[model samples]
Target: MTLERITLAGGCFWCLEAVYEHVRGVHRVESGYSNGAHPSPNYEQVCSGTTGHAEVVRLDFDPAVVSLRELLEVFFTIHDPTTLNRQGADVGTQYRSAIYWHTEAQRALAAEVIREANEHHGGRVVTELQPETNYHPAEAYHQHYYARHPDQGYCAFVVASKVDKFLASFKRLVK
Candidate 1:
């Protein structure tokens, strides 16, 4: 089966990574920084909001099992896309809602998803649909953070909440 890749930034990479890790048809999920000016930015630089980088997850999935549209649907369900440059208490450009589309078709689909989301909901969709660009992997400690540190304070409180929401909302998609 051919695999497709899409990178998204909805909030903390840890939150996104935790949710997607349980999603069926998601071959892999890697936490990283994307659309940044810096060539190889560390977590600190990205967090500083000076690198122009957003904390993103690069997903590898089999389209036959999980359509891009369905993936985006789950994405919207798990995060508050209406909030600009932030998710929950994480406030910064790195936590902004964004979709980095890898193809023209993906770009159109991303826009359609945003449109549908807005139409279905009462508020505006703050998620940005942008072309995919360079992606730099975050520090080693950040990858699979929630899984590795389930008992950690932030993982137990913040990341776990999002994971529960994802599992509850997308039961059919869960592995």
Candidate 2:
């Protein structure tokens, strides 16, 4: 069972984290900041968009159970790849859609996914595919936020919609 890791940012890490947690082969999802200037940036600093970082969820998964292509499909479905530097109400560089690929293979797969998505939607895919960079885990409170606070306003209104979409669209892929 070989495990691989990929870092992605589509909006608030909480939303992405919540969706991936239910993915069949996902081992773990850690909310973090990546491609930033700071060695170890705090959430506040990264939120300011000065760190050049995006709020990403570092996903550890089994390739046999869930291929990178499948993962990217879920990712593209849950987030708006056409939007630049924003996801819904969250607007900033930190919320930009991006894929921080860990290897050449992942890079190629990400590019293929983006190309396919763009072709399917008939619009430009704004999602950035870049090499993996330094990742700073967000504050402990931010981890599993939706699970721990499902009734919270943001989770209820925003994250829940994505979760529902994931569950509905990927019923066969769910564990």
Candidate 3:
């Protein structure tokens, strides 16, 4: 099956990475840095909140199993799209919400979803939709982080809750 790519940044990459891993159509999810000027920026540079990079996850998925709109729906629910440059206690541009669309169609779908999401939340959705640039895969250690470190406090407390919520609400989309 052919796959399409979508990149997103919402809060910590760990959280996004964890949720998408269980998504049905998603074939691969790689944590990365995107929409930044810094080439090959490391996690420290990104966490410093100066690189203009958002911790993003690039996913390869088959639209047949999961529509792009469905993915965005899951994305909005998993994170507070109304929040600007932060999620929970994580505050910084690195944690900003964004959707890096790979095609014109993806961009349009993202816009439609964002508009509907804003109305649903009764708050402006700050999630940005833009073409992707300057993407660099995160350090290998960051890959499948939640799966590898489920017992870690942040994963257990923050990431797991989002994952559980998505699984419960979007059961049909889970693999």
Instruction: Give a tens-digit lDDT track for model 2, residues 25-109.
Output: 9999999999989999999999888999999999999998999999999999999999999999999999999999999999999
**Backbone clashes under 3 angstroms, per model:** 0, 0, 0
Instruction: Give the alpha carbon lDDT tens digit for every residue of 85-119 in model 1.
Output: 99999999999999998889999999999999988
Candidate 1: list runs displaced more than 4 Å: none
Please give, for residues 77-127, the per-residue lDDT of candidate 3 as tens digits.
999999999999999999999999999999998989998998998977899
lDDT over C-alpha atoms for residue 41 of model 3:
99
Worst 10 residues of 2 by lDDT: 120-129
After superposition on all CA atoms, what RMSD does each candidate show versus the true structure? 0.9, 0.7, 0.7
lDDT score of residue 67 within candidate 1: 92
Give lDDT per model, in order: 0.93, 0.95, 0.95
Q: Model 1 — which ten-residue stretch has the worst lDDT? A: 118-127
TM-score of 1: 0.97
